[model samples]
Target: MAELHEQLQQLWSTANKSFRNVAAYGKRNGVKLSPSTVKGWLGGVVPDSTTALTALVEYLETAAERESGWQRLPGGEWAALYRAAHEAKVKARQKTSAPATTPQRASSAPTLQNSTSPAQPGDIEKARRILKAFPLDASWFTSFEHQASFHRIHDSVQDPLYDGQNVLARNYKVRFLDPDLQRQSEKFHDTVNAFLHSLDHMDADGKSGYSQIPTEWRRSFRDQYESLLRKLSGQRDELMTEYGALINLFNERGIPLLPNGS
Candidate 1:
């Protein structure tokens, strides 16, 4: 069966129009839509809200009647597919984040405890939960793929027709910031901020940011972008390691540090 994204792509193909055109059609029908939202769906990011999904389904159903006369998937069927895809993605993440089981020794040997006391029974699972609940990924580079997609889409469509300054029109990078990373906190944030400050210092030939780098500088953009991502990713790894250690410390003491009833 087709996943939500695949079904959306099929609808787009059947519509036979640019995303801008489809969005315009949506506007005509009193449905607010943006090309980037469609692009996000195509990139496997589920629709942000049920209202957006319903508007998209309506737009696709009749967006290309004159050109291809192709009717899109019915609303009920599309909703079912979306729910299945969402559930599948959730299950996959849960499976990935689950803690590994430690093998048991056949011999019941008395182990001498050190002053540092090794992790207790549920510590591994608690650490896993903490890592799973952390807002940022273990690596910033992994999230960079999604950011790169946003930039590419912004570059393609942010012209005279689209108001690039409009927040709704512009597709910004997705940032998964942990609450503990805030300046108010007394931990892992400093290193993260250092990397972020490096990004702030970068000059894209007077352009607004990496996405708007001049055409001539495009050749070096990938290298520059990936280099920064690598540095940030290293910092992210360190942050995750430190966060896991902190979680373990709390877990050992029976302190509830999981994210607000997580």
Candidate 2:
């Protein structure tokens, strides 16, 4: 079976760009992927989070060498590969951690390591630790990796973010977490839209409207651009607080998706 890192290396080799270029592509596409993260993926680290894997795969699709006729695998095939690789890594970890006892004792060992349970405050703390393993910044609202970090914590504690009636939000496309998550996500997309609109408008307008527009009218454009450029410390703090609320709410409601792991 091909490991994910090995497959990533093969894909990287087939692409025309270097790791830094790939990282830059990720940033443009709203993922906070770094060159070091790409290097780590090539160095045998199983991308426990799918966001990084998706970023790399999508990057390769855009960066493929057309002259050489290179093409990435189909989306379905990529999904299969990711599932296989993740399963293989999980199995390997389980095998290595297995006790050296007799067959009977080994069989008696618990198999519910991933069982669901309400996320305790301790689980929240542990999730915070896991979040530390990934990069974070003011741009986290646009970074799917930041969203994935919360999923990791939720998965580890066996908490499902979905409401019972709405399973579609948990899918690859929407990825709905907290209501705040959705709100912030929409806000980020709006900001991106505004930036694009301003870019196109400025390019078309040029100096034609330079002296015609009032001071506030010109500053309105500047304000929109500045909003896009300004630091998002408030948003970041809000997200952090929302994460904590998710855990606390689930814990109080006693509605975890599964029993606590042994």
Query: How big is the positional error of residue 230 in model 1, measured in Å on the Cα after superposition?
Result: 23
Residue range 1-262, candidate 2, lDDT tens digits:
5656667777777776764466466668877455434544565544557886787787686666552666766557766777886676567546533443423455766533222434444444433432232113312323423442121111111111111101211111332233333333334333422322222111111223221112343466767544433323233344455444544444443533232210
Deviation from native of the Cα of residue 233 in model 1, angstroms? 17
Candidate 2 has a TM-score of: 0.37
In TM-score terms, which candidate is top? 1
Flag regions of model 1 displaced more than 4 Å: 25-32, 105-262
Which 10 consecutive positions of candidate 1 have the poorest summed lDDT? 160-169
| lDDT, residue 176, candidate 2 | 23
**What lDDT does candidate 2 reach at residue 106?**
50
TM-scores, one per candidate: 0.41, 0.37
Residue 31's lDDT in candidate 1: 59
Tens digits of per-residue lDDT for model 1 on 1-262? 7888777778778777775565566667765455545655665655545677787777676765655887655548887987886776566546534544446778897343333554454444433443343423322324443452222213322221122112111121211122222111224333433433333222222133132222433466777665555665565466446555555555554545544225
lDDT of the candidates, in the order given: 0.47, 0.42
Model 2: residue 57 alpha-carbon error in angstroms? 1.2
